[model samples]
Target: MILLQINQVARLFGAEVLFENMQLEIQSQSRIGLVGRNGAGKSTLLKIIAGIESPDKGTLTKTKNLSIGYLAQNSGLNSDTTVWNEMLDAFTAVRQMESRLRELETLISTQEIDSPEGQRVLKEYDQLQHTFVEQNGYSYENEIRSILHGFQFDATFYQQKVQDLSGGQRTRLALAKMLLQKPELLILDEPTNHLDIQTLAWLENYLQNYQGALLIVSHDRYFLDKVVTEIYEIARHKMMHYKGNYSRYLTLKEEQLALDWKAFEKQQGQINKLEDFVARNLARASTTKRAQSRRKQLEKMERMERPQGAEKSANILFKIDKPSGNVVLQLEDGEIGYDKHVLAKNITLDIRRKDAIALVGPNGIGKSTLLKSILKEIPLLKGTLHYGTNVSLGYYDQGQQKLQPQKTILKELWDEHPTTPEVEIRSVLGSFLFSGEDVEKTIGLLSGGEKARVALAKLAMNHENFLILDEPTNHLDIDSKEVLENALIDFEGTILFVSHDRYFINRIATKVIELSPEKSTLYLGDYDYYMEKKQEEAELLALLEQDQVKEKSVSAGKQSFQQTKEQQKIIRQLQRKIGQLEENLEQIEEEVSQLELQMTQPDNLNNHFALIELQTTIDEKTIQQETLYEEWEKASLELEQLDS
Candidate 1:
């Protein structure tokens, strides 16, 4: 079913039209990704769809009783209530049903079993219990725990007041609450903000299995690829939809643009030929009729508009003034933190002359703290740090604290490079898309993206040999991020940066350093390679444990070893069975998803018999999946017990 239909939607800001003739239909389980360049009114369109803001000239028709949960970009939860209480609010109706069930129980206990009143109370209890189970009242608290844990909120945080949490934590809590609500339609605007790689992965997995439709606006390409199956791009004050994930969307978009250009060129050639013929023959007496016919053809022709070009992107290039020593940076037994509070210790890192390393860890695990420690902004708690000769370090602060708030954008870069010519400074700023009057804007008044560009402009001017960046992609849109990634990839300098953007890390990093309180592990390749290595290590470790268990059984004697071997054999069989069941269940789910998508098509919607057939197939697949799930769960438990 179409949960929402937006027809000819138009939004405006003052005299400027953001988007017009925007049409979209969200199905009951659509997974849509909204993407565009910064300031292209993607968020404005989301607000219009979410019904948070009205469109200047359009209408939104929603399904009756449709429930929507909207989380604006960086919109944190603000409440005096504790975290547990805030989450509980999402389950008020279920909780109310539980209360009534208790009341029914009480009435049943006080009356005779043979009486009509007693039987009525029992029926009421049974009905409420059924609804309670369907609504997940029994498992809701556990669901809350699982979601909060995924967001890195532990049991200890349950009692904490929302006001007491940090801004980022509050934003996470808001998202957590939305997930708990499980609305029919979930509309998120930049929901990935303030999330670490680990949290982003968890969120992607959660959203993949989410029942409701998702309309997400995220610059995280990897997340979008994993979560959303459709892409809606808003560019040049228009919205266009493409079927597929982010990577597929890119491919389709490029092909479309190429095709559009070809058609436009073909039409332009025809138009040129027609005009030339009309001009040459219109004045000639011998071809006057033909010329008039050509003119008429030209007047009636539906001219093809010129194909639009790629949107403007920031031009970022990192240059080194001179070559640095082979060893760009070295940290030995580093203990980094604020004063005596150490966040991570026993950290040892050796950064080479041209290696781009990505520092990764969970949020608040001290990725930024380590960067600050290396810069000597804060003293290293318990170790030595060194920079090699001829290494000029340029830092990009994620918070933009390095910028002079009172200074203009022009002055911000010019002051840093006082010897450079005024025209040269303006030219560089213009490359970053700060042209004309935009250069006069104060740093404090500029948006996050603008400040990021200013920072990049400053970094470019320094021509540093070694760059230490902290979440450098925080405020950049997708286009700007790709530009920055290309720049960093082409840079000759050594780079050590902290970023939660997996796509960015995959693009630019030659190595990855994972931080933990216990120790640091170094991976020799990018983010994807790091994950692969981690999985291999985990499997290896599990195998080692199994071997150790076998050795222990051998130590017990030959008869015991035989019994242990048999048990292990059974465990392996059970594991294989569970794996087969899981694979079958996955196939069934995919089939059901395809069937549902088919049901949403215009042709199938108009064909009543087709819709019923598709839905019936989906229902059968769902039932089969539930049975497989039960078998998988039972086998998994047996395997777990045997392994234990």
Candidate 2:
């Protein structure tokens, strides 16, 4: 069943066409991922669907009475209502019906049973009651509470005034309200900004089972791949629909790009051959007729103009410097978190050179604080951290303080690279989405994404050996994020960044850090490895719970003091083992980097013996990394058996 259809949609801003002659249809079960460059009008399109804005041309028709729940990128709350009260307002219709039913009870008490007015009131009351029940009024509160609980929001925060809460908190409250609304069509823009990994996972699961259609405007590729089964690429002022997730879309898009590039080359080759024949033979009187014939053929040949892709999203290739040492950055009993609320415990982390570590946790787990701790901006409650000698550090915040608002694009980088020429400054800015007139714009005038790009461009000036980024992909469009992701993947530096964008993390992160506040468990694995470990942990916990239930019937206690104590001891031991394994893994990773450096050196190329030796060493390092993870996992199982 088609829920809504956008036909011949067109919008213009000052003679520049944002999107024209665009057509798209959203089905009842459709999960569409909207993609475009920064100024391509994705948000405007969403507004049109939500009835918040009108298109200059075309029609948007929906199935009759289709309810819509739109969570705008920045939806402000004016009413002084708490987060919990704000959510409960979605139940207003049922509440009104219930109130009316009570009023009718008063009327029925004063009227005769034989009177027509009393009978009419009684009928209306029954109708209202049925509608109330049909809407699941009985379990709605429980469902709302569960949704809020899933997001890691405590009960105390629920009653806090929305006006008093932070911007991120308001957005979370708005999301909860929308969930309670449960409209037929749900539209979300950049929904993962304030969400933690656990919350994001819960949202992914929620949308997977959602009965409503979803139209998401997000740069988080991980969210898109998990939630969307189809993609709508808004390019060149038109909507191009594709079947499958972002990964498949990437593959098909690359193939199309390659095919177009080849076709353009083939056409150019033919044009050149014809022009050559005409130029070389035109002066010969004997070949005059042939030359004239060739000229006519050239004139008659229908040419295909090459399509120019959006340059804003182009790849920014970089030359990464070599990894330097075995130790990147090591922490000893680090207690990192925000304020007095200690989110992370005794985090003895070791980030080695050439290691790409991604901080993975639910939102508000002080992932950013951990990065800040390493930066020395935030004090570690208890720990010692050391970075290897000659290691450089580059910081990229999603939209944090890096580029000054008053600073011009050229001035921002030129100040850092004083010895560098103006032409080099222009070149760096151009690669980062500021070119020509854009380079002249002050940093204050730039969009969030443009500002982020500028920050990255300036940071690139340092050529840092380690990057600490906090949600670097937040404001970046699909294209810019991809470019940044590719650059990080090829970067030869150690990276410890906090990101909820799983796709970006998966591309660059060789290791992950999962922070569990209540349990204070930190798991180290790559994106996929972390996921696998998570599932295993969940299953283990469930098994433990089942065992406890069995013990309740047999022993009439929650296991025993000795058994419980033993389990706790084993858990701590397992955590220590995992930490040790990570340390070993870092060492192995460093060796691999060293071997690669040796193999790539000019002196070693001619010496096959040395190259072969380095290759063997690299192979050994990989085996060691894998072996450590397997052993760590095995040891974890032994700890789980302590309570048995």
Candidate 3:
């Protein structure tokens, strides 16, 4: 079924037309990706479909009772409530039903058992219970917990107030709640903005099982390739649909453009031939009729418009004035971070000339801090970092913090190279997409992407032998990123950069360094190779944990057969404690099951107070069960030790 349809949609920004005559239909379970360059009105189109904005000229139709969940770029949840409570609020209907069910249960307990009022209450409760089960009331908390875990928001974070959360955390919370709401259509704009590689992987897995339709706007080509089955590209003030993932779309689009260009050129050749014949023969008396006929035919011919090629992307080239030593950089047991606290320690790295190394880690794991330490902008907490001979470093700060806000784009580059002529500086700036009056614009007035380009322009002028880039691809558009990637891939100088853009990393990185608080691990390959190794390591770790558990069990079994007589009393006590813990576990498990069943009933689902009470009870029981299991394990271990 078509969940939504947009016909002849037109949007205008003053006199500039963003898009026109756009038509789209979103069918049930469709996985559609919307891709376009920045300022192409992709987000605006999403807002229009989401009912957050109205199209200037268009008709939008939706299936009856269709629900859409839209998450705009960098959108954060605004709530004073605790994180857990905010998520719970997404299922207000379920909570309301739970409340009513509880109230019905209370009334049933008070009324005569054989009375019609009591019987009606019981029936109502049964109906509500069934509805609650269908709505997943019994497993909602577990679902929330699982999603929170996937987002790296643990149990401790659930108690944190949403108002106190960081912007990125709030954005994650918004996404989490939207997923919990389970709307028919989920529209996400740049959903991968703040995600680390691990969380991105988790989200991909989660969405693969999602039941609803998905419409995503993202610059992450890798993400789009994984999740989207169809692509809609907004270009040249028009929307073109392609039936496949991003990679397939690229191939199909290229072929289509090639065919279009060929047909256009062919038509142009025929038109020129007709025009030439008409011009020469029209003046001749013998050929006047033929000339007139040719002219008429030319006039009647349908002309094909020239096929529009890919838009121009910024040209980036990283060149070094001189070559550095083979050993470009060395870090010996280095510790990086603040003076008082070390973010990562025992790190050792040896970078060679012309090697492109990508540093990757989870958010807040100090990838940026390590970069700063390497640049010596900040004091290293410990150990030593040495630069090889003749290594002139050029740093690209992702935040563009080094750029002076008061300076114009032109001045920013010229000031760094006082001897360079103004024309030369302007030429370099123009290469980075700053042209004419754009050079006069103050750095403060520039957008993040503009600032990034300005920084690149400055870096280009430095003529450094080595480049240390921090989140270099953060604000770059897809095309710009690809250009930069290609530039770096071709550059002879060494590179050490931190980035979460897997596509860029894959394209440019020759080696990967995975950072953690404890240490850093090196993988001698690109991003994909690094990921494969990480997966293998994870599987091995899981197997090790399983082996440890089995070892403990085996130790217990052996000890049971070889117990000393003097240890008999202690073993008996341990066994008694274990039995008690097992009993408590069974009781808690039974109570949890019963509570879940009760939560599914109509009366319990409708009773708000009862629902809250039941949820609280379940939470307590779960905690208690976990505690008992730990105690039971400890007792069993102790019993085995005594026997041995």
Question: What is the lDDT for 253 in model 2?
Answer: 78
Worst 10 residues of 2 by lDDT: 547-556
Worst 10 residues of 3 by lDDT: 549-558
Q: What is the lDDT of residue 638 in candidate 3?
A: 86
lDDT of 1 by residue, 1-644 (tens): 99999989898778988788888899999999999988888888888888888988878999999999999999999999999999999899999997886666567658785689876766666566557657876457768878998999976799999999999999999999999999999999999998888899899999999999999999999999899999999899888899999999999999999999999999999999999999999999999999999999999999888888788788888888799999888899999888699889989999999999999999889999899888889898898888888989899999999899999999988887799999999999988999999999999999999899999999998998999999999989999999999999999889999999999999999999999985678999999999999899889878985565433222244557678788878976886687689789779867865875675576864554464466457658767876786687688778766654
lDDT (10s digit) by residue, model 3, range 53-82: 999998999999999999999999999999
TM-score of each: 0.84, 0.77, 0.86
Off by over 4 Å in 2: 104-118, 255-323, 337-341, 518-524, 549-644
Off by over 4 Å in 1: 110-123, 546-644
Backbone clashes under 3 angstroms, per model: 0, 4, 22
Q: Weakest 10 consecutive residues, lDDT, candidate 1? A: 548-557
Candidate 1 local Cα displacement, residue 323, angstroms: 0.9
Each prediction's whole-model lDDT (CA): 0.87, 0.78, 0.87
